[model samples]
Target chain A: MIGMTLILKKINQLIVGLIFLYGIYIITHGHLTPGGCFAVGAVIAGAFFLLVLAYGSDILKLRKREEGSSVAESTGIFIFLVLAFTALIIVTRIFFTNYLPKGITGELISSGVIPLYNIAVGIEVAAALFNTFLALYL
Target chain B: MELLLSIILGLMILGAIYALFARDLMSALISCGIVGYGLVICFLLLQAPDLAIVQIVVETITLLIMIAVVLDSSREELKEKKAAEVKLSHFRKWYVMNVILIIVCLVVLLYFFKEVTSTLDPLGKHLTRMSTAYIEYAAEKTGSANLVTGVLFDFRGYDTLGEATILFTAVIGVLTILRVKGKK
Candidate 1:
């Protein structure tokens, strides 16, 4: 399908970068902010959606990138599982234990493995949702 | 705030009714979106910023997915089916029965809700034992400033893991169903 008009395309091009940046900020700061992995992941997917709407699916170079996103989705969940199991293997030997140091609260790097989990979830969700979008369009 | 909430909820219900009755599938989807955003607003009013943020994004994604599905289908065929083959009186009977059943269900639900909430502590003062512990100790235990995130990813990590697995399964199912095979 063809995309929108030139003015719409210009607007989408200008705003998509900002959207991605905001989504990244939300995902990274999930431990300290109201937003979390699922929310920010949807936001990032939304950026992709806008791009697809404004420039058509061809703009994504889907043939090359589809497999990449699928891999990323699997890798994200794998990383998340690894992180969870590492805690189980290490300190407490219990599943989903927080074995890492709980640094000072409110710091960027304070939340030990929580931030990492958030990042993993964010990647998984963003990739999965984008892949779903691509599948529907293709 | 209560008045505003009531107004928003009333509008949401109106939108839902509109969606139910809308002949055009696209307009019905739009009405569904309106109701979704109205719920987002309700979440914000309830002081759940996290829920509000998540709801809005989820709503957007859902709307996009629905739009894609609708676009992929033949709209002309859907439009042509608008002319009902069944008589109006036949539908009126079913519609009245449905309305009566809904009213009965609503009354039963309202009674059960009243009974359940009456047994619990008053609204503003109520906090279950586990939640109180979480609020008091989640910061010290998890070192996450956001208690919701701490509870979701750390304290209740297994639940989150299960959720992730569910999403993964859904994606796999979608990919499997939609995979395009090359002819040999």
Candidate 2:
């Protein structure tokens, strides 16, 4: 563990989880909210950075994430393609069509496939960027 | 609103110029961040919360990366200079010339700034012609209240797909570039 300071560690313990939760909230509520995939992805990546910066990059909990980041990235893209192709192959003959049931206008589950896309993109961008950070960091 | 945005814009430009001239790479990088964060404020002022969120996050991430780079590269201890007087004189000459050139550039930019402003539509008076269709049908057709996501994920999903692929490729590229040579 390459910790910088005890103050940073204390601050990070208090703040990083909230930032991560906020990122998840942004991703899930993307259809109803302003933020979506890319924004939330960066937010989550920032959370990872904050944690690593405080607790050191060698945190065993996060090491698994960095290790599987490439796989996670591919999985995200794969899910996106599967969602699109499902729209194409199954019911709607068009690509990327919102085939799922559209719930209420302002509800969380309202936007048919938009939230799904948000989740996929959030995963994709978060993993890719976090991977880069772990790599470039000394 | 326009006045506030303009002030922020001026600050951004000044910060950019300061970043160019600042001797300490750390402060220079932080001033560079001023430009990015200022744009986030501009986005919010323009009623684009989506863009503002995106901009701020990406800006912070990039800034953190830059901070890491600078922190790793710069030494904590200062090294004594062997030829301080001669180096200072030579450095001052080059710095003065660069400052003069930057001032000339700033003058040209300021001179043209009015013309550019004159051509632009006032803030918040943006022409809604291109966005009107999305504004109308995005909610109904896509069933998403946030029209930005509607258009991005449903309407023009191919673009999003391509964007994701591009990010994947970039990650691969970075990993490749950073790979340790002769390490299995």
Candidate 3:
């Protein structure tokens, strides 16, 4: 795993950023597109996996970041639950209710709490998967 | 599109058979990956892009996990091979029985498939009420343009919540099992 080759390493470095960006794009556009939180999260985790393969586990700072990923995973789920509960409390008084105004279709900010939920789930999935990889690698 | 789907499905069946009979663990894992990707292609051809996206990602992660397990237990696997070979001879009768059972099952399934297809309307004239309702009202009810997302996150939010909880529990279980003693 210690840098497949100089050219491969360089290419991986260049493409990792784009991969992450694409993952984020998919997550954010979940309400409007075919891709959703889980798909985007996996894509982001793929980027991390690629990073690990290119640079080796030691250089990825996996040891130090392992705790961070665990915390992020928990926090993401916590945020999702809180959002669901808030919807219960403030909006429809029913759990998981989509209460916000359904803005015009095809807009970025149209889906009320769906986008937020997607982002939360995306974070949870990405962190959980990356953490699992780190655990297995260790 | 139908031809492409049939090809992919045939390849998936081939991959599954190869994985089942592969002598080495690594090749079996690789063949499993091939089957998983073929399923993803089949999903895409069925016009389920969301399923395809999710399946492809899951397949990749599964491959990585299998590779890690294989690497970790390489020596153990090698050690077990001799014992496995000894047991294989003893299990030959059962293997043959299982193969015959599988062929019988496949033939029965093919017969049922033909029966069902011949009875069904070719034009899909009979849509289920729930699906028709969803198609008609999903955008209006959830305000999401993507009907699948709207249904998953809005109409079926409880189900999604349950799915999330299940995933969380699985991760927690994995972490608990793999946790090193005396290490935080």
Candidate 4:
């Protein structure tokens, strides 16, 4: 029975990891696919949920009792705004306009602001969701 | 053409009514879920996949949060009761309010939906028609595979920042509500 339980635990972790990877895949392919920042973020959050359920609150890596969660939440917001402000400043000063280069299409390096925006959004959403789960669960 | 539109409209109205009139909080919540599902259907009908994806995520999170809050509050109540003799007065009251709120919310949402769809401009039309070009352009520009990310972060990055801040505020609100003095 104990051995069975241990194997089940390992399988759970593997499943969670797969789910997390799937979320990343979805987020990264959001623009070209059916998923997006929100979908992928929520899926990533689901991975955490799976972990919490499998290991219980005590074993979860992202704890609700930690002050770091709140800090992380704010940091995502701060980073997003700082990046945006930087872009705005650079555009207004150097290029004489806010026009960033819209590079070649569908080659993993296009869309001036779209990918950066998606990533920022993904991070923001993941952190916010984790914070929410922690606050409620803890 | 009209038949399809009317079917969707009918589903929306029915979902709204069910969401509002359900007798239990859980049932009311389920109704809300239906409302959300209906909204997604409507979004698809309008051919707005981007908006639909965002809406699904937002709705799912909202539902999760609501469920969490409801679960947390109920635990305390459950502990104080013998589980058998517990009355559902609060649940009943919430249901009544839910219907009223759903009606009000549906009216508001329906109005906005009609207005937005009608007012879609030439630029909006062009963007949807040529979204592939934008997606391809975004991929080469942002060094990311996610086109939504490219557009949202690189082009309209400021809006994303604002959205992050709103989420941060919600986290703070949750913390403030749940935090206990002298308890880690």
Compare the candidates by TM-score and give the number of the best one. 1
Between prediction 2 and prediction 4, which has the larger TM-score? Answer: 2
Count clashing residue pairs in model 3: 0
**Runs in model 1 with CA error above 4 Å?**
A64-66, B68-87, B91-110, B182-184
User: For residues A1-138, could you state the per-residue lDDT of candidate 1 as single tens digits?
Assistant: 568799999999899999999999998889998988899889998998899888976776776534778998999999999998887887688888877788999989887899999999999999999888877676
Write one digit per residue (lDDT tens) for candidate 1, span B109-135: 999999998888764575679888998
Task: Report the lDDT tens digits of candidate 3 across residue range B3-63.
Answer: 8878888898899999888778899899999899998888877788999999998898889
Question: Given the true complex, what DockQ would model 4 score?
Answer: 0.42
Instruction: Using TM-score as the measure, name the better of candidate 1 and candidate 3.
Output: 1
Q: Per-residue alpha-carbon lDDT of model 2 for A10-118, expressed as tens digits?
A: 8888999999999998898899989889998899889988887777767835434237777888899899999999988997898888888998888988878888888
Q: What does DockQ give for each predicted structure? A: 0.81, 0.76, 0.71, 0.42
Flag regions of model 3 displaced more than 4 Å: A1-8, A64-66, B23-26, B68-126, B182-184
Model 4: residues with Cα > 4 Å off, grouped in runs? A1-15, A61-68, A85-102, B68-151, B180-184
lDDT per residue for candidate 4 within A27-96, as digits (tens), equals: 6666566666766667777777556645666674443446565665666566656555665576554321
What's the residue-level lDDT of B32 in candidate 4? 80
Query: What is the C-alpha local distance difference test score of candidate 3?
Result: 0.84
Task: Note each model's CA RMSD in angstroms.
Answer: 2.9, 4.2, 3.3, 7.7
Better of 3 and 4 by lDDT: 3
Question: For model 1, which pairs clash?
Answer: none
> Each model's interface RMSD (Å)?
0.9, 1.1, 1.1, 4.4
Cα lDDT for residue A41, model 4?
Answer: 68
How far does residue A14 in candidate 4 sit from its true spot (Å)? 5.6
